[model samples]
Target: MTKEKFKSLMQEAGIKSKKELAELMGLHYGTINNWGNTQGYPTYLNNYFHFIIKAKKYDEALKKGFDESEKPQECPSNVEALSLENARLREECEKYEALKRALKEALR
Candidate 1:
């Protein structure tokens, strides 16, 4: 989701900030903001909201709980997408390292 839309969702759900949402999914602060901007989140956090919804027994139940002076929540899909993106970024870094090693070997 776009940052604006994500921010809107938080507002509609009565959430305060990305930090709270990230904490709900056991993520670092700014994780949700990054996900909203980049369309990716952590895999472990993917099913976080699903669990919360199931535990609460309604789509908005968790939100309601949060609205009632509790904290925010994280959704599974967002977390999964972000995890994939993070893995992809890690792989890219590995490739860069390999290329650097190869270049050093050639120069030597």
Candidate 2:
């Protein structure tokens, strides 16, 4: 999502900053900032997008007086969220690998 949309999500969720939202949604502070802007690679960007979407869905459900525990949650569960985060970490690793290859090429 665009920075403005992400910011709007934060507002709609009734939070002030990424840190607060992170705490509320159990997301890493960095993940929220990554959503705010491109951090490095857009590898797991979709995961964050899905996460925010799910959170919004959950919030909407609550507002609608739905019982979340008995209902099917379209949002990413804990495992799914972790899996998405793993994709992000893998992307970070790839960047380092690319840098390493560049260094090796330079030495050659």
Candidate 3:
């Protein structure tokens, strides 16, 4: 990725500076600086940043609970279907959290 796009992604992911990102990724600050000055970031960085952003959204969603306005109107008429959908959503959330943890461990 280009340095500018990398910086934008970092900002979107709530990473304030290149040094902070370096710390999170277990890399030297100069290594990150070099990417901006000379070599560009690896292509995988795009996916990594996107994952971080999505993970942050997941965290917020879990904390606030699902938005009622986002729920389907017809769910109220079908209690069984609603229960089944809730269970499936919970399972999917668990899987996402597990994958996020695994990725963090691997990065370290």
Return the top candidate by TM-score: 3
Per-residue alpha-carbon lDDT of model 2 for 8-78, expressed as tens digits?
65565556777986686687888767754566424554465567678888888786655556645644476
Off-target runs (Cα >4 Å) in candidate 2 are: 39-108
What shift in Å separates residue 60 of candidate 2 from its native position after superposition?
Answer: 12
Estimate the TM-score of every prediction.
0.34, 0.34, 0.59
Candidate 3 ranges with C-alpha deviation above 4 Å = 66-108
Candidate no. 1 TM-score = 0.34
Candidate 3 lDDT at 78 equals 78
Model 3: colliding residue pairs? none
Total colliding residue pairs, candidate 3: 0
- How does residue 68 of candidate 3 score in lDDT? 57
The models' CA-based lDDT, in order, is 0.65, 0.70, 0.87
Per-residue accuracy of model 1 over 1-108 as CA lDDT, tens digit each: 345655555555545777877776576776566684566644644355445445555756756745834543445556789999999999999999999999999999
Instruction: Assess candidate 2 and give its TM-score to the true structure.
Output: 0.34
